[model samples]
Target: MKRILVPTDFSAHAENALKVAAQVAKKNNSEIILLHMLELPHQMNDAITSGASIPETMLFMKKANETLDEISNRNYLDGIEITEIVKMDKPIHGITQVSKEYEIDLIVMGSHGASGIEELLIGSNTEKVVRNSEIPVLVIKKENPDFSASEIVFASDLSEEAYLPFEKLLKFAKLFDSKLHLVTICTPNSFKPTHEIEKITKSFISKFDFSNLETHIYNDTNIENGIINFSNSINADVISMCTHGRTGFAHFFNGSISEGLVNHAIKPVLTFKV
Candidate 1:
C-alpha cells in the first residue's frame, strides 16, 4: 500500500496539509502516517543541564501528546490506518530520519513562507524537507481549500533522473483527473538535440496512461524565467519539479530553481526529489 507521511507541529498549516493528504490517500486507498516532532524550548534544555525540575519536562511532553490527539480527533481521519509518531528533537532531523526509516512515498507539510533572518537560516521546515527528501514533497499553504489543480506543469531537464518520479506524478494526475503538461526549457548555450526530440518524448509518454498529456519546448535565456513564463501562460494550477538540494555557498550563490518558483509563482509548487 502507498505510505504517505505528514509531519505536524500542531499548527493550522500542518492541519491543512493533513486535510489535503487525507483526500489524496482516500482516493488512492493508501495509508497515512501522522508525525509530530517536539523540539523543547531552548531555555528548557539549559534549565535541565542546570538541574531544573524534571516534572516540568514531563508536563511539556504530556501537552505535546494532547495536542497531537486533539488535532487527530478534530480531523476525524477515517478509513485509513493512521499511525502517529511523536519525537522530541530537532524537527527537520526527526522528519528526515522517519521518512527514510518508513520508506515514505510522499511527504505533506505546511509552510507560511519565509521572513527576515529566518529566510537565510533555513527558510522553513517544509523547504528543508523538500530539498533533503528523496521522495515527493507537497507543501500546502494554509488559507482556503478552494484551490483545485486543473493543469499540472512539470519542469524537467529530461535527464535520467527526470523520469524517476513521473510514476508518482502520474498517480497524482490520475487522482486529480487533471491534464499533465510536460515542459522542458532549453538554454541558448545548451547543445541542440542531435537526435529527434520527439523520439525521446514519445518514449517517455509510452510509460504512462496519459490520455490527457501535452508536450512543449521553450527556448529561453534563464531556467527560472522560462518556467515562470510557461506556467503563467498556461495558467497552471500547480508547478512540479525535482531539486538536488544544494546548500551553503551553492544555495547562496545559485539559488534553487524550485525555491525561486515557490517564491515567485502565483500558483502552488510541488517538488519531488530524485
Candidate 2:
C-alpha cells in the first residue's frame, strides 16, 4: 500500500473514510491523497452572459480547498504524508482520473448506502467508482470502522470469473493477516444441494491452495441479504467480493451483486473488478 486515494465531500461518512485510510497509511508507511471534487453548476446562456455562474463556481472551489486543507491539518495526520487535490469534475471522474495519475494502490471512499430502485438509479459516487476503477476499492459506510481486519467474509458463487478477483482479494486479506470465511449464498432461485455446494467450495479452496480459511453455504432470499446476514453472524471485520463492473442502463438489467452489497452491507467492503 504505497499510495491511497480518498475522495471526500467532507461529510461525516467521508471523514470516517479518511480516518480509516489514515490507519492504513500509518501501518504501511503509505501516502494519502485527499481529493475533493467540485461539480460545475449547470445553467443557461443567460446565466453565463450575466457572469452569475463564475463567482458561484469559484466560491464552491474555494470552500472545497479550504475544507481539504482543514482535513489535512488534523492532529491525527501528524506522521502521514498528505497531498490535497481539488478537481473540477464529477466525483467519480475526478477520483478515477487521479487514481490513474498518481498510481494509487487503493481507493478508500464513503457511501451513503442507497438501496433498491434508488440504489440502481441514483447510485452513490463511491458506488460508481467501485464499478469502474481498475484498482481495488474499500467502501466505508460508518464512522470509525475497525481498520485492523481480523476476519474477512468473502461471498461469491465460486465461478471461474470470480477466481481472478478472489486472487486479488487474498493479497488484500493477507495485509491484515485475517482469516477468510468463504460463503456461497443459496437463494431460492439458485439453491444447490449441500453436497454440490460443498464440493465446489472445496475445489475452489484446493485450487487456490489457501490456508487460514473456512467455507460454508448460507441460505437467504437473495444474495445481498445473504451476505449481510452471514457477515453479521460471523462478526466479520470486512466483506470482500468481486464486481462485474456493469454500467449505464445496462446495470439495471445485469444487476451487479457487488454494487448491491455496497448499497446494503454495513461493514466495510473491499471490491476487485472481475
lDDT of 1 by residue, 87-171 (tens): 8778789888988888888887766643321331124666677777777777665543555667999877555666666767887
Off by more than 4 A, model 1? 46-51, 75-81, 113-123, 142-150, 186-211, 219-221, 245-255
RMSD (CA, Å), candidate 1 to true, equals 4.2
**lDDT of all the models against the reference?**
0.70, 0.78
Clash numbers, per candidate: 0, 0
Local error of candidate 1 at 63, Å? Answer: 1.4
lDDT of 2: 0.78
TM-score of 1: 0.78
What is model 2's C-alpha RMSD? Answer: 3.5
**Model 1: per-residue Cα lDDT at residue 129:** 76
For every candidate in turn, the CA RMSD to the true structure comes to 4.2, 3.5
